[model samples]
Target: MQIWIFSYLHFLWALNKSMIIEWTHKRKNSHYISMIR
Candidate 1:
């Protein structure tokens, strides 16, 4: 049961990390587009 909880937490952390990365990338792209205009 403890192992299952640990793995679940790890999965959540990884998901959060990927979401942050994707959000930052999207923001950077929008900034670039605005600059071009």
Candidate 2:
């Protein structure tokens, strides 16, 4: 039970981090494109 809880928590943490990374990357790309325009 402890192991299961830890695994689930870690998965959630990793997913959140990946989402933040993707969001920031897309935001940077958009900023760059806007600058080009």
Candidate 3:
């Protein structure tokens, strides 16, 4: 039971990390597009 909880939390953390990275990437891309315009 304890191991299962730990793995679940780890999975959430990894998912959150990837989401943050994708959000930042999108933000940077938008910024570049605005600059180009």
Candidate 4:
């Protein structure tokens, strides 16, 4: 859960730079699960 929150925060930061790199593996998986929850 913490990891998902962390990445989401990072996603906000990446918007300033450009965009997040394609999330694969646990990164993307956790994001989707968190969203559903």
Candidate 5:
């Protein structure tokens, strides 16, 4: 039971980390496009 909970938490943390990276990348791309104009 403890191992299962630990794995679940780890999975959630990895998912959140990837999401944050993706969000930041999108934001940067948009900002770069606006600056070009």
Candidate 6:
């Protein structure tokens, strides 16, 4: 049971990390586009 909880938390952390990375990437892309325009 302890191991299962640890793995679940790890999974959530990884998912949140990926989402943050994606959000930053999108923001950078939009900034570049606005600069170009």
Note the Cα lDDT for every prediction shown.
1.00, 1.00, 1.00, 0.77, 1.00, 1.00
Q: Kindly list the per-residue Cα lDDT of model 1 for residues 1-37, writing each as its tens digit.
A: 9999999999999999999999999999999999999
lDDT of 5 by residue, 1-37 (tens): 9999999999999999999999999999999999999
The deviation in Å at residue 26 for candidate 2 is: 0.3
- Residue 4, model 2: Cα distance from true site in angstroms: 0.4
Q: Mark the regions of model 2 whose C-alpha exceeds 4 Å error after superposition.
A: none
Clashing pairs in 5: none
Clashing pairs in 6: none
Tens-digit lDDT string for candidate 2 (1-37) = 9999999999999999999999999999999999999
**C-alpha RMSD in Å of predicted model 6 compared with the true structure:** 0.2
Per-residue C-alpha lDDT of model 3 across residues 1-37, encoded as one tens digit per residue: 9999999999999999999999999999999999999
Decide which is better by lDDT, 4 or 6: 6
Candidate 1 local accuracy as lDDT? 1.00
Worst 10 residues of 4 by lDDT: 16-25
Model 6 spans > 4 angstroms off: none
What TM-score, computed on C-alpha atoms, does each candidate reach? 0.94, 0.95, 0.97, 0.41, 0.97, 0.98
- Report the error of model 5 at residue 34, Å: 0.4
Per-residue CA lDDT of model 4 for 8-33, tens digit only, reads 99988887555335435558889899
**Candidate 1 ranges with C-alpha deviation above 4 Å:** none
Score residue 32 of candidate 2 by CA lDDT. 100
Number of clashes recorded per candidate: 0, 0, 0, 0, 0, 0
Better of 1 and 2 by TM-score: 2
